[model samples]
Target: MINSKFVKQKEVSISVPPGIDDGQMVRLSGMGEALEGGVPGDLYVKIHVRKHPYFRKEGFNLVTEMEVKLSEALLGADKVVATLDGEITLKVPSGTKHGMILRVKNKGVPLGGNRRGDIYIRISVQIPEKLSKEAKKLIEELKKEGL
Candidate 1:
């Protein structure tokens, strides 16, 4: 419901179709008031989509970032990632580098005709922000071993 000076307090119904991009306009025929004997004006609604906290749209594809532990980056692990549909397990390959993109097929926005774009997950390895004494010792040992 929207309030305007032109139309005191009236409820308007708008039907938005799928595949409508942000800033696209949807026309509502005969919704605006006519001038004297003239025909009613058409109402154009500009669409604005809010940003998702865990997902971003790139064209038709959906992009998101997943944070993996340092150990998981070094020794592969099956981690749960959030998608538009829901949570799913993604296999993290060993020796995976930061910012590497993993593609999940057909998980993006619909592009009409049953076809959809892919979902890309960018890997972000999370290093320990604080290291304990034992953790520091292990790192020193690995450093001494030329790791």
Candidate 2:
């Protein structure tokens, strides 16, 4: 019989092997017995396999990082896709500052009962990894102009 006081809390994903019946009584080795019964009782469990990538906190939106090209960052494009999901394009405004937050209402996590959360896009400026001679010369010219 499983002990009643041995239950532990878990936050991450857990997979139950196939052929497990729904509403079946089972206990983890460490998880204890169910209440009201001196003997061990079947432990209740809920299984969910997949989840979205973003984690949300109240009063704050969350999204993965995405780097914009120098021209894109300077000109400020209309939308930039998130790295985790390329199809989810987040809009950007002109003169967007680095780390600027763009909030999309109701584009976030599901709060149940048909309610949803928000999504935020953080702007990032990207620099070229390897600069061609012409690019380097342009940078030098810009430096001369104190730009």
Query: What's the lDDT for all of these models?
Result: 0.87, 0.58
C-alpha lDDT (0 to 100) for residue 45 of candidate 2: 63
Candidate that scores best on TM-score:
1
TM-score of 1: 0.78
Q: Please, what are the lDDT tens digits per residue for candidate 2 over residues 1-147?
A: 975566557664344653233344444543446556566554456644343454334432446555667767666676645432235656565556678777777655555565666666666777789999999999899889986
Q: Write the per-residue lDDT of candidate 1 for residues 15-45, one digit (tens) a residue.
A: 8876578999999998877877999898888
Indicate the TM-score of model 2.
0.51
C-alpha RMSD for every candidate: 4.6, 9.2
Candidate 2 residue spans exceeding 4 A from truth: 1-43, 46-61, 80-88
